[model samples]
Target: MWLPLLVKRLNQVDMQKKGLQLTAEEIYDINNASLKDAIVQFGGFCTGEFISKEGLLLTNHHCGYDAIAARSTPQADYLTNGFWAASRDKELSNPGLFVDILVRMEDVTGKVLEGINAQTPEAERAKLVSERMKALAAEAKGPENYVTYVRDFFAGNEFYLFVYERYNDVRLVGTPPNAIGKFGGDTDNWMWPRQTGDFSMFRVYADANNKPAAYSPNNKPYQPKKHLPINIGGVEEGDFSMVFGFPGRTQRFMTSEGLKLAVETSNPARVKLRGKRLEILKADMDKSDAVRLKYASEYASVSNYWKYFQGQNAGVKRMKTVEGKVENEAKYNQWASADANRKAMYGNVLADINKGYADQKEYTLSQVYLGEAALAPAAAKFALNFVPLQKALKENKADDIKKATDAIKEASKEYFEGFNVPTDEKLFAAMYQMYYNDVPKSQHPDIFKTVETKYKGNWNKFAAEAYKKTFLTSPEKLNAFLAKPSLKTLENDLIFKTVNSVYNNYLTNINPKLQAARSSMDKATRLYIAGLREMQSDKVFYPDANSTLRLSYGSVKDYEPRDGVHYSYYTTAQGILEKEDPKDEEFIVPQKLIDLIKAKDFGRYADKNGELPVNFITDNDITGGNSGSPVINGRGELIGLAFDGNWEAMSGDLVYDKDYKRCINVDARYVLFVIDKFAGAGHLVNEMTLVTTPSPNASTASTSAEAAKADVLENVKPAVDSKTKVKIKKEERKAKAKMKK
Candidate 1:
């Protein structure tokens, strides 16, 4: 349902019919400042949009969760007590956090595929394409600081070149406390009727010339080419909505066998492994706030996907997605057999895919267990860092040894900061045992034999002894070894040996098989997709998301999750109060918010019913990296922030269920209310251009108090002075005049 921006121009007429006000050029013109200029790939994972010329950005609270948690501590406790920087100078800097603004994207498919034909071998074709792409990227990346890369689309059937300007000086502006930002916690995650105010604010800083720069005290806020005007007007049920962002990935083209493997083998294994890890982490976290602070981000991340896999399995079953894929494949086969040319190209595609998946099944599951279980413990994963160090030591290369040692020393500081030995030991015991029991005996690592013979098959006992003997769990010991620089010391370490053996076995035995199977599947899939496009020539084929900028347009709507229950399109503050629990941490509401709700201190942000809108649902197609994407109305104004999809559509990445695929967004009104009234960060609001037109859903109200409030709001001075407003209008007119020519 999501189309790459390149294809948006082709669908411009169709999009206009759906109520889009802006032209395709207006949305993505490289020559003039357009809507794309306002958007950024936040921290290389989520999406964010510029809300002010001074580079004030808006993204989901969860999207900024890790950066916020990293800065939090028991004393400052920014996580519990929200952060608000009253001025630019007061903002906190986040090292290594950066945002990339896409400068432009151009199709380079013909150039990339040059000199490669059907006669070319798969490996040779791939090599040629890689060489061409590298050359094209180098040419595109001139003397500027722009980062250029080529990404394949439609499963290598096409490619596009993306140019981005990355700014490393992004700062946290403001965020509501977890009680507000993560109000429902995991319980309400991916669920409907959510009241979580999930928005967070940040500001991008740059050098004096408004170019990307590293964090510096003297750096000023960036002046973006375009910023979205915030529309406070509430949405109606049927109003046009569009979500634009970098949607991470989707496997809509995945074969039935792939779906079966995911649902039955990979997902369940990951769920079980992460579930155990979470149990241990939560136990320790609950016992102490310090532990919770240390592991909060990790817990959130693990639990998010743990729940996602569960929902995805259930949704896949409920939607009968695998059966549907099988039915589609049957049709594809029938279509392919009708013509000799098609049969020659695609006759083997499905058979190859089925055999490839079957061949890789056990190896894929083994790899999953190897990753999720064998490397589940922080200590085991941390030990991987010393692999290069060991190799350098063996080679007797002092420069490589010194470089590796310095890197480990720096890495150990961060690792030890969050590493809890007791918790990691438990994780090691549980996860290793899971891997040993689940994986076949033939595939077992050499260390499992040691555990069975030396430790009498007692994983806990082996783990305790391993933790005691290994330097990985102790920074002091690690540093001591680094100072001494002994290959024998590292090679003999039990944890290092265990991690190395697991990796070595996989590298020697499993990876080659998996890669070979995957290569066959990849080639078949590319041909299958190309054939499908040819067969269904009348249908518009949108490529699956690959972390590229995309646009999905739809309308605000509601749905029935089941036979008798119909859900509303939007949630309100009243739902927040209804869900609040005095004892439960997840549902606890701040007394300030509770009092404000009870007092009905709703400002101009209130909807027609005099209730504060919390979150709304749209049919916009989205996926993982679409988090914090701006939900824009037909007029091209920011209406909300897209955060999560409905639970009934958890398998959306594999199959988009039109009826159940609802995009959950925190209402822009709620975001503003929390920022302006709750956090007292009106200056951030003043930075944005506020659109106050009444919504289509607004109804006449005759209350005297309402009239008084409206009058006061109208009389308030605009953020921009009258002269500046006139100047802006004149500049806008000049740009339009130039566009006309």
Candidate 2:
């Protein structure tokens, strides 16, 4: 570990020793939900500089996919190997994707609190608050067109006004083929000592005058004033790194029950769904190169989530961190258990939310699995069915029927085309078997029957036949059979329409029943909350995330995954090489990377640790929105790209694990290697402004011995997972006050 493994505080992270002082302005700006477009977005994520002059923007590889997917055809397989324009003119245009620039921020806490207080009836209160906020946003105007969303927390205790400038000048720049962008596969996700190059490049295109623009071939790359320069000097133990991005989601403010639900119910359900998706996508991808290419991005997108869910599960289990969820729940229970009046108002609410979870618990989980498993194979058939549906709708035969048909028409174009029948069917069977064997037989009788009929009661039989007869083995026939104008889609035409019907039944019929259950549990929760609040009304509390700008800080850290499995804080060039398993398609590392390590060509970014890093750690609070953020040193130099977090901390999505969760990031050194060594784009590397270390001072005998010890103790992790020097329990430092302080 060339970087010092950071230790996270359950409450605070002290950084005074690092000369890490936040200006009063920076501290104020960081805490509020304001006009944060410069480096943060309302959605809780952002993009930042790598090479400021070259206009290079660094973000999560996955974050740019919409723009990437915008230009995708069934023919262009960009998501697999990724998109790279040989020249700027070749860049694909995506009009909708934009970078928001923060123009102004104001404290709207007073107004928001007033709005909340005026509303009664919880749901009505929520709606009223939303209406007032939207009216305010609609009234705003600025350099860029953007929407304003309101965030209310601590029961309307806090509010902040945000004004942003949206930049439509965004365009695809470069990305590694998925081979590099997604190396080390599922097993390595969310764990430390990772070797993925999870970086993607996008350019902000502006008009001749450098303002936002719609699609234009002549649009030039916008120049940014604060693009980060690479400090190739690299990272070492005891170094400081901070990430700036709109981390999309985090649950630093979840109730204990909410946290427990995430750990016990949500995570498992997500994992099951993702697993089903991967099972379907992998089979289809393997059947043909065309299918593989067409669905490459879609598949990769699903895989990212699949890996994430599993990683989150693993992260929690590895560190014995699940205790956080239970403890949090207990705290909530304690607070809510105090009185009668308070409990009556909230009792039903908590009961309702919880019962809602319990009711949909299985069905919601089933939906993700069922979506890909049962329906995707018959997609084209549904498409063909829609032609008749349109004709029927035109005839005005029946509004409800036409509505159903019209619904299928929209779904056919969106969801079905992205699927391959064989892959989907096979995936369905694997999951069906899991269901049949695992879930109680009473819950899903009809789907079980379909499974038995589709495969003749044999999971493999169904999978093999579905592959040979449906999507994978016969794509052309599927297209031909389903696309005929005269075709009337069968009720069994596995498509989004059918899935929608299931959803309607669930939502309209099933979900309501589930809601009723939640309503019941909510009775208990509300009662508890009410009682607790009155008893401790004088006590303070914080609100959960409201999709507003937030900041969480931790230090670079390493933690044990399992009893014997310890992951280091950072990975090195050696770690990447060690994980390369040629036989496994998912784990391949580039030969060029292997050569770079052997050659020791760190170029400008190797830290004093003397090893090129693959990924590093950070303590910045990030969630979904924080994807693709740059982890900068205290000097604001680019050092890493935030990617995944330790799986032990998955529950953090709903419960902040002060000690378990860590932000995983790719070291900037790998970004250079991918560009200079593998991509043969040394020009990009040359454009970067870099920092150099000052010469070391002469050391006396005792000082010399300590320096030597520091060198060895700091830089040990290489291609393999190795022990990296880490900071243990230490003193806390005060957050530096801004100028006013």
- RMSD in angstroms between candidate 2 and the native structure over all alpha carbons: 7.8
Candidate 2 structure quality by residue, lDDT tens digits, 1-741: 100111122112354354344432332343442112235341134454435554566776666665566566657867665677777777666654677755555556666546344225666755666677776666655434654555554445445566665567566778886667877666666656677888878777778887767768887777654567676664654566565555455445434455455567656766675666677677767878766755766666667666676666665565454465456445655554555743444434444555555665655444444443444344423434454554564565665455654565455454554565556555555655665664445445454576567656777665555445432224455346434422233343433233444444445644566556555554354344444455566763334545444444445666654443445667677666666777777776667667877888876556555677778776556677667766766555666788877666765555556666688888787887777777877766666676653211212212765565444445432224222212222111111112114
Q: What C-alpha lDDT values do all the predictions have? A: 0.87, 0.57
lDDT of 1 by residue, 584-631 (tens): 888889999998888878798988668899999999999999999999
Ten contiguous residues with the weakest lDDT in model 2? 1-10
510, model 2: CA deviation in Å? 1.6
TM-score, model 1 to reference: 0.93
TM-score of each: 0.93, 0.75
TM-score of 2: 0.75
Q: Give the lowest summed-lDDT range of ten residues in model 1.
A: 717-726
Highest TM-score scorer: 1
